[model samples]
Every structure is written in structure tokens, then in C-alpha cells.
Target chain A: MSQALLFYFFAAVAVLSALGVVFHPRPARALLCLVVTMFALAVHFTLLGAYFVAMAHLIVYAGAVLVLFLFVIMLQGAGAREIALHQRFNIIYLLPAGLVSILLAGGLIALIRGSAFQALKSVDGTAENIGTLLFSQYLLPFEWTSLLILLGVFAAIALAKKDAA
Target chain B: MIPATHYLILSVTLFSIGILGVLIRRNILLILLSIELMLNAANLNLIAGSAMHGRLDGQLSAFFVMVVAAAEVTIGLAIAVLLFRQKNSVDTHEIKELKG
Candidate 1:
């Protein structure tokens, strides 16, 4: 019962903050809202017994990725005048988007409800187990991810560097 | 124990909101954030499945998803920065070179 309650609370937080990320007018505030959403998701991960994943999510998402977003926003300075001029909400666009999202959620929920899930057992999501699995069964993909990260670093540097005239 | 159906429902809700954000927001940063939101929803589904099945495969997959998400954000933000440098604006509608 308590697990259900905890799940509901965090689930509500995740959904609401996610909405904030969408509807908040200011970009910085929207990013903060996304951070809250990430925190709630980390909690959900913990509740689901994926402890290592929960920690990694916090570090990778809230720690690194969001800071990158903040740096970019700070560097550009999303000015108020620009926001007021271009960020006005349009009901025509919103209406269709809302309809589509509602349709998608309804369809997915209906499908989920139709299926029967077996009883759940809490998995061991310890760091040691994940490390072993990463090194053994998933070693190739794991190494490939390191290469992907290197590529991403080079790409970011290349794209953001100013060209000399 | 919470039912898997509930987790699935929550994931669906989050994913839908992400889609809505992507479609309605004109700002490029918000669009990228929405994509992150969608990715998180998928990660939630994977973790829940991992727990339900009493295995670590789903968690490993979620880890990979996170790595990919990180790389995606890096590339995406770099593109956003470049766009701002060229156009002095991060609004999506400003870029229409491919509208033909």
C-alpha cells in the first residue's frame, strides 16, 4: 500500500513538472521544471528497484545534461523581448497538438489495460551486478558507447566553434 | 507492489506530454527538453520491466538509453548554439530554408 502511495505521489510530480516544461513561458524556468521532472523520475526508478539506474539518471541527467542546457541558455541570454515577440502561445496550434497527444495517451493506456502482467519481483539493480553485465554480455556495446561519447565531444566542439574570417 | 499497468499508464502520460511539448513549443530549447522528457518516459518503462521480470537486462538497456540521450543532447545543443549564432534567434519558425 505504501509503495502504491509513493508511486502515485512521484508519478503526479513527474507529470505536472513535465507539463511545466511544456507550458512555462520562460526557457530557464522550463529547464528548471525539467530538472524537477528528472528528480521525480529518479524517485520512480528507486521505487521500481533500479537503484543503480536511479543514481546514474541523477548524475547523467540532472548533473551533466541539465548543466549543459543551463550554460547554453546563459550564454545566449534568451531575452524577454525576443521571448515576448516570438513565444506567444497560439491556440490553433495547441488545439491540434493537444488532440493528438490525448489520442496517443488514450490509445496507449487502453492497450496497457488490456494486457495482463505477471506478478513482479524486485530485481537486483546493484552497481556490481550492472558492472559485471556491462563487462560480460554487453562488453561490445559498452565499448562502442565510449566511442560515441568521444564522437559527441568532437561534434559539439566542431559545431560551436566560431570560424575565423 | 505497484502493478505494472500503473507504471505503464504513467509512462504513457509522460510520453504524451513530451509529444505535446515538441509539437506546440516554438523555442528550440524547450523542444529538446521535451525530447528528453520522452526519453525519460521510455527509461521508466524499461526499468519497470526490469523490476517486473526480476532481471538486470532492462536496467542495462536504460543505462545505454541514458548514454545515447546524453550524446543526443550534446549534439542537439551544439546545433541550437550554431543556429543562434547564425540567426540570432532560437525560434524554430525562423529557420525555413527547407520549406520548399
Candidate 2:
């Protein structure tokens, strides 16, 4: 019972914060909402027994990536006023929006009705298990990921560096 | 007990919101943020499915997803910074010229 409650709570918060990320007028405010969504999803990860992933989500997403986003927002001096919102509603867009929402709802229903979700397994996806798997069958991908990070670092530096006139 | 369906539904909901953000927002930074949100939704699905199947593969994939997200964010923000410097604005509509 409690687990269900927690799931509902986190899910609600995640969805709401995600909406805020989409609709918030200011970029900085939207970034905050994005942080909240990440935190809520981390809690969900924890509940699902992915403790290591939960922590990484918090650290890498809320900590590092979001900090970069905030820094860029600050560097750009708080957004241009004209671009705060891109869409002005027209009567024509209403039909597409409604259709998309309906399709999304149908997808949700199909997901819930699937047989794979009928049983709840209480498995522990602990960090130790993940680490074991990471080193064993997943070792190749693990090494590749580190190399990708290295490439990303160099790419970021090259991309962001100012050019001489 | 919370079934896996609940988590899946949540993931879909979050993904839809991210899609909305990407579609509606003009600020390139916000669009990147939306992309992150979508990636997190995918991570949530991986973790939940891992729990459901009694396997660590889902969690392992989530780990990889995080690594990819970090790399993408690094490069994306760097581009955003460069765009701001060159164009003086980060509006998606404004940076139309390819030469810059």
C-alpha cells in the first residue's frame, strides 16, 4: 500500500514538473522545474531498486548537467524577452494538440493493459549487482562509455572556445 | 505493491511533457533541458523494467543512458554558448544562418 502511494506521489510530481519545464515562461524557471523532475524521477529509481542509478541521476543530472545549464543561462544574461515563448495559439493548432493528447493517452492505456506488467517483482537492483554486471558481460560497453566521455570533454572545449577575429 | 505499469505510465507521461517542451519552447537551452527530461523518462523505464524482470540489465542500460546524457549535455551546452557568442541571442528561430 505504501509503495503504491509513493509511486503515485512521485509520478504526479514528475509529470507536473515536466509540464512546468514545457510551459514556464522563463528559461531559468523552466530549468528549476527540470531539476525537480529529475529529483522526482531519482526517487522513482530508488523505489524501483536502482539505487546506484538513482544516485547517478542526482549527481550527473541535477548536479553537473543542470549546473552547466544554469551557468549558460547566467552567461547569456537571463534570456531574450521576445523568445520567452514561441507559440501563440491558433485555432488550427488545437486539433493537432488534442489528437496528440489522445494518442498519448492511448499509449498509456496500452502500457497498463500489457501482461508483462501484471506481476510485480521485488528484485533488488543494487549497486553491487550493477557493478558486477558492469565488469563482467558489460565490460566492453563500460570501457566504451569512458572513451565517449573523454571525446565529449575535448569536443566541448573545442566547441565553446572563442575564435580570434 | 506498485505494479510496473504505474512506472511505465509515469515514464510515458514525462516523455510527452518533454515532447511538448521541445515543440513549444524557442530557447535552445530549454529545448536541451527538455531533451534531458525525455532521456530521464527513458531511464525510468529501464530501471522499472529491470526491477520487473529480476535482472540487472535494465539498471546497466540506465547507467549507459546517464553516460550518454552527460556527454550530450556537455556538447550541447558548449554549442549553446558558442551560439550565444556568435549571434548574441539563444533563440532557436534567430540562428538561421549556417555560416555563423
Candidate 3:
């Protein structure tokens, strides 16, 4: 019972804050809302019993990713006026986008409702189990991810580098 | 324990909201944030499936998704910064060179 309550509470937080991220005018504020949504999702991961995943979610997303977002938003001064102006002209796209999203959600939910999910015992998401799987079954992909991150770092630097005038 | 279906529904809702944000938002930064939302929603689905099936594979997949998301965001924000530097604004409508 308590688990359900907690799940509902965090789910509400996640949804509301996600909406904030979308609709908030100021980029900084929207980034803050996204952080909130990330934290809420982290909690959901915990509730689902993926302990290592929950921690990774918190550290990777709420910690590293959101801080990066904050730095970018701060570097660029908030542009409320520009956003307001854009919002005025972009109202035409709003209704159609909202309708499309609603239809997609509805269709997915109906499909999920029709499927019969087996009630298997929940898996243990301990670090030990994940580590074993990572080093054994997933070693190749794990090594590849390091390469991906290294490439990402180089790309970011190359793209964001200042030109010598 | 909450049913996995409920979690799936939540993920779907979150994903849809992300789609809405990506479609309607004019700010490039906000579009990136929306993309993060969608990725997180997918992560939730994977974890839920993992819990439902009592397997570690789904969790591993979610972990990979996080890695890819981090890489994508790094490149994406760098591009956003580049766009801001060249254009002086992050508004999508301001960039029309690609319209042709």
C-alpha cells in the first residue's frame, strides 16, 4: 500500500515537473524543472527495485547532466522576451502537437492494456549482479561505451571551441 | 508492489509529454531537455520490464541508454553553444539557412 502511494506521488511530481520543463518561459527555470523531473524519475527507479540503476540515474542525470544544462543556461543570459515573442507566433503549432501527442499516448496505453504481463518475481538490481553481467556478458559493449564518451568529449570541445580571429 | 502496467502507463505519459515539448518548443535548449525526458521515459520502461521479468538484461540496456544519452547531450549542447555563438540566439525560427 505504501509503495503504491509513494509511486503515485513521485509519478505526479515527475509529470508536473516535466510539464514545467516544456512550458516554462525562462530557460533557466525550465532547466530547474527538468532537474526536478530527473530526481523524481530517479525515485521511480528506486521504487521499481533497481537500486544500482536508481543511483546511476541520480548521479548521471540529476548530477552530471543537469549541472551541464545549468551551466549552459547560465552562460547564456535568460531570454524571456525572445521566448514570449516566439510563443506568440508559434501558437499555431501548439494545438496540432498536443493532439498528436495525445493520440500517441492513447494508442500506446491501449496496447499495453491489452497485453498480459506475467507476474514474475522481481529481479535483484544489486551492483554485484550488474557488475557480473557487465564484465562477462556485456564486456565488449562496455568497452565501446568508453570510446563513445571519449569521442563525445572531443566533439564537444571541437564544436564549442572559440575561433582565432 | 505496484503493477508494472501502471509504470508503463506513466512512462507513456512522460514520453508523450516529451513529444509535445519537442514539437512545440522553440528554444533549442528546451528541445534538448524534451529529448532527455523522452530518453528517461524509455529508461523507466526498460527498468520496469526488468523488474517484471526478473532479469538483469533490461537493466543493462537502461544503463546503455543512459550512456548514449550523456554522449548525445554533450554533442547537442555543444552544438547549441555553437549555434548561439554564430546566431546570437537559440530560437529555432531565427535560423532559416536550412530552409532551402
Candidate 4:
């Protein structure tokens, strides 16, 4: 009963913050909403028995990616008037988008509910078990992740570098 | 105990919200953030499935997805910064020079 309640609470927060991310007029505030959404997701990860992923989500997403978003917004001086979102208030566009989104979501939920996934066993999902799997069965992807990060760091620096004449 | 279908329903809702954000929002940064939300929804699915199946593969994939998300955000923000420097605005509609 408690688990079900927790899921409902976090899911509501996540969905609301996600709405704020898209519909909020101010970019900075929208970014904060995005952070809230990420934290809520991290909690969901914890509830679902993925502790390691929960911590990683908090660190990488709520910690790093959202901070990057704030940094850029601050540096760019995204003013209230400039990012006012007045121009994007077209009902014609929103009406169709809303209709399609509802249709898609309804169809998806129906399909998933109808599927048979009840007999599956639950895993421990402890950090040690994930670590062991990372080293043994998923070693190749682990190394590739490191290389991908290295490339990203370089690419970010190069892209944000002040152009030299 | 919460059933897996509940989690799946939440994931689907979040994913739809992300899609709406990407489709309707004009600010590139918000659009990117929406994309992150969508990715997070996907991660939630992977973790939930992993928990249900008694397997580690879903968590492993979620780990990799996080890595790629971090990288994608870095590169995307860098480009957003570059765009701001040249254009002085990050509104998607303002960027029309690239359209052929």
C-alpha cells in the first residue's frame, strides 16, 4: 500500500514538473522544474530497487546536466522579455499537439496493460551485483562509455571555446 | 507492492509529456530539457523491467543511457552556447538562416 502511494506521489510530481518544463514562460524557471523532475525520477529509481542507478541519476542528471543548463542560461542572459514565449502561444498548434499526445498515450497504456508480464521474478539490484555485471558481462560497453565521455569533454570545450582571430 | 503496470503507465505519461514539450516549445534549451525528460522516462522503464525480470541487463542499459545522455547534454549545450554567441538569441524561430 505504501509503495503504491509513493509511486503515485512521485509520478504526480514528475508529470507536473515535466509540464512546467514545456509550458513555463521563463527558461530559468523551466530549468528548475526540470531539476525537480529529475530528482523525482531518482526517487522512483530508488523505489524500484535500482539503488546504484538511483544514485547515478542524481549525480549525473540532477548534479551535472541540470547545472550545465543553469550555467548556459546565466551566461547567455536569457532575459524575461527575450524568452517570454509570447510567440509560442498559438492555440491552433497546441490543440492538435494535445489531441495527438492524448491519443498516443491512451493507446500505449492500453497495450501495456493488456500484455502479460506478471510472472517475472524480482532481482536484488544491489550496487555490488551491478558492479560485478559491469566488469564481467558488460566490460566492453563500460570501456566504451569512458571513451564516449572523453570525446564529449573535448567536444564541449572545443564548441564553447572563444573563437580566436 | 506496486505492480509493474503502474510504472509502465507513469513512464508512458512522462514520455508523452516530453514529446509534447519537444513538439510545442520554441526555446531550444527547454526542448533539450524535454528530451532529457523523455530519456529519463526510458530509464525508468529499463530499471522497472530489470527489477521485474530478475536480470541485470536493463540496469546495465540504463547506465549506458545515462552516459550517453550526459554526453549529449554537454555537446548540445556547447552548441546552444555557440548559437547564442553568434545569434544573441536561442529562440528556435529566430534561427532561419539554416533553412534552405
Candidate 5:
């Protein structure tokens, strides 16, 4: 019963905030809603027994990413977006795009249908287990992903510089 | 009593909404926010599958995914700023100068 309730709560938060993020007209409100969604997803990660992932989500996304977004929106000023949105709202490009999205979703569900289910055991999805696996089985990819993140940071900085002039 | 398919379906539905946001919304900020939604949906599926499969690989990939999402948004926002500087508006509709 507890598990079911937890699932319902997280799912509701995730789904609702997700919609709010997309549907909110104001840029700041939309960014804030997405932040709430990311935070709730962190809780869902905790419920799934991945404590490290939960904490990482909170720290990286809620702490860093959303803060960056909020700062950017505030710095750019909300009045500009409001003025533009008031002038024109064209959604004619969305119909075909939405259909393509629906088709992609159907494809994902069909792919999952073909996969075999393996029952879980021991439920040891903790930080210790993650650390163990990281050092033993996934050491190479661990370093590689770190390199990828560094490259991403550099690329972002470079992009900003290239257009600054 | 939870089925794995439930998580998958929820992720798919959220992904679809994100796509709609990207495709439908005219604001660049909204488009970027939609991208975040899509990435979160992917992360949820990853963690859920990690729990079900008795492995940490999915969770690790999810960590990387979050990192990349943050990085992508930063660069995207920066570009949006540059565009705003040039064009004075963030509307995807009216900012189409290179449409070919």
C-alpha cells in the first residue's frame, strides 16, 4: 500500500508539473514548474532505491541548471517575452509534429513489449553498490562520461564566446 | 503490484508532451523547458529500469544524461541570449530569418 501510494504521488507530481512547464505562458513560471518536476523526480529516484541518483538530481538539476535558467530569464527580462507572445501565437506547425511525436511514442512502447522481464533480487540499489560497480565493472565508462561532461562545458563556453561579438 | 510497463508508459506520455511543447510553443524559453521535460522523462525510465533490472548501469547513464541536459540548456540559453540581442525577441515564429 505504501509503495502504491508513493508511486501515485510522484507520478501525479511529475505529470502535472510537466504539463505546467509546457503550458505556462510566462517564462519564469514555466522554468519554476520544471524545477518542481525535477525535484519530485529526485524523490522518485530515492523511492527506487538509488540514493546517489536522487541526490545528484537535486544538486545538479535543481541546484545548478534551474538556477542558471532562472537567472537568464530574469536578466533577459520577462517583459520582452510578454510583448512578443502578445503579438503573435502561431501553432500551425504543431499538428504534423505532434503526430510524429505520437508515432515515436508508439514505437517506444512496442520496443519495450518485445523485451524480456527479469525479476529483481536483493534490492541493493544503494550508493555503495553503485560505487562498487563503478570501480569494478564500469571504470572505463565512468572516466569517459566525465570527459564528456568536460567537453560539454567547454563547448558551451566556446559557443557563448563565438557569438558575444 | 507495480508493473514495469507503467513506468515506461508514463515516460512515453511525458515525452510526447515535451515534444508537443517544442513543436507547438513559439517561445524559445518554452522550447528549452520542453527539452528539459523530455530529458527528465528519459531519466525516470532509466532509474525505473535500473531498479527492475538489478543493475546500476541505467542509473549511471542517467547521471550522465542529467549532466548533458544541464549543459545543453546552458548553451541553448546562451544562444537564445545572443539571438535576443540581435533580434530583440524570442519568438520562434518571428525569428525565422534563415528558413529555407
Candidate 6:
């Protein structure tokens, strides 16, 4: 019962906020809504027993990313101006979006039907098990991924610099 | 009343909205935010699966997903800012003036 209630609540919030992200005219309001959405998602992660990841998600996305987005929006001073409507490619865009969604939905449905998707009972996705697997089996990927992130950061700075010049 | 499918469906619904936002919304910043929403939906699925399977793999994957999402948002926002400076608008539509 508790799990069900949490699922519905988070799901509703996620849906609503995602809509807000698209429909909200003001960039600041949209970004703030995204932050609230991220916080709710983090709470959902906690309820699912991924306490560590949940906290990390909150810190990185809501704390860091949202702040950065807000900073950019403020620095740019893009508010009070109307966003241009690029409706020319709407039809073309819908084709890809619909196709992608259908394909993914189909694949997920197939996988669920062919596999066991029953609700797990207290599997305890604790930080310890995550650390163990991440370092042992997924160690290479994890470390390399971090390197990629660093490179990505440098790339962003490079791009920013190029833009500035 | 909520079954595993309930969570799955909800996640998919949110994911679709995020996807819709990315495709239809013309603002680069809003598109990036939508992408974040989509990533969170995937994280939701990961955790929900972990909850159901009694395993830690889902959470582990979710952890990795979170990391990737952070990196992606950083890069994306940087590009968006650059675009903003060049075009004077974050709207993706007015960017037709890009020179090869």
C-alpha cells in the first residue's frame, strides 16, 4: 500500500512538472519547476531503497545543474522577452519522437512479458553492494566514465571560450 | 491498488511528456530540462525494478545514469549559453543563421 501510494504520487508530480517544463513561458519558472521535479524524483529514489543514489541525484541535478541553469538564465537576461515559436519542423519532429517512443515502449513491453517483473521485496539496494559491483565488475567502465565526464567539462569550457571570442 | 505495471506506466507517461517537450519545444534550455526529466524517468524505472527484483543492479545502474545525466546537462547548458550569445535568443527556431 505504501509503495503504491508513493508511486502514484511521484508519478503524478513527474508528469505535471514535465508538462510545465514544456508549457511554461518563463525560463526561470520552468527551471524552478524542473528543480522541484528533480527533488520529487530523488524522494522517489529513496523510497525505492536507493538512498545513496537518491541523494546524489538531488545534489547533482537539483543542486548543481539547476543552479547553473538558473545562473545562465539570469546572466543572459532573456526573461521579459518572448521565445520564438519554431513551428516549421513540428510535423517532422513528431515523426522521430513518436517513432522513438513506440519503439522503446514496444521493447519494454516485450522484455517485461518475457521476463520476471514481479515486485521485489526489500532487496536492499544499499550503497555497499553498489560500491562492490561498481569497483569489481563495472570498475573499468565506471572509472572511464568519470574521465569522460572530466573531458566533457573541458569540452564545455572550450566551447564556451570559443563562443566568447 | 498499485501494481508494478502502475509504476511502469507512470514512468513511461512522464518519459513521453519529456520526450515531447524535447522534440516540440523550441527553446534550448527548456529542451535540456526536458531531457533531464527523461533521465529521471529512466532512473525511476531503474529503482522501481530494483524494488521488484530484490537486487542491487537497478540502483547501481541508476547511480551511473545519474552521473551521465549530470555530465550531459553541463555540456548541454554550456552549448545553449553559447547559442544564446550567437543568436540573442535561446529559441531553437531562430538558429537558421548558422554558418558551415
Q: What is the TM-score of each candidate against the true structure?
A: 0.93, 0.90, 0.93, 0.92, 0.88, 0.86
Better of 4 and 6 by DockQ: 4
| Candidate 1 similarity to native, TM-score | 0.93
Error of 1 at A50 (Å): 0.6
**Which residue pairs clash in candidate 4?**
none
Q: Which residue pairs clash within candidate 5?
A: none
Ranking by lDDT: 1, 3, 4, 2, 5, 6
lDDT tens digits, residue span B1-100, model 4: 6778788888988988888888888778878888999999999999888878878799889999999999999899888888888888887878898899
Query: Residue B9's C-alpha lDDT in candidate 6?
Result: 72
The TM-score measured for candidate 3 stands at 0.93
The C-alpha stretches of model 2 lying farther than 4 A from their native spots are A79-104, A111-116, B98-100
Of the two candidates 1 and 5, the one with more favorable DockQ, higher being better, is 1
Least accurate stretch of 10 residues (summed lDDT) in model 2 chain A?
A82-91
Interface RMSD, every prediction, one decimal place: 1.4, 2.5, 1.6, 1.9, 2.4, 2.6
lDDT (10s digit) by residue, model 1, range B58-77: 99999999999999999999
Each predicted model: what fraction of the native A–B Cα contacts (within 8 Å) does it retain? 0.80, 0.74, 0.75, 0.74, 0.58, 0.72
Interface RMSD of 2: 2.5
Worst 10-residue lDDT window for candidate 5 chain B reads: B1-10
List candidate 4 stretches off by more than 4 Å: A79-82, A88-96, A99-103, A119-121
lDDT of 5 by residue, A69-122 (tens): 888778778722543444333568578767877798779768778887654322
Q: Candidate 5 local accuracy as lDDT?
A: 0.78
RMSD of 1: 2.0
Instruction: Compare the candidates by lDDT and give the number of the best one.
Output: 1
What docking grade does candidate 6 earn?
medium
**Superior candidate under lDDT, 2 versus 5:** 2
Off by over 4 Å in 3: A79-82, A85-89
Ranking by TM-score: 3, 1, 4, 2, 5, 6
lDDT per residue for candidate 6 within B1-100, as digits (tens), equals 3456666876787788788878977777778888888888888888888888778888888888878877887788888888887778776668886656
Among residues 3 or more apart in sequence or in different chains, the pairs in candidate 3 whose N, CA or C atoms overlap within 3 Å are none
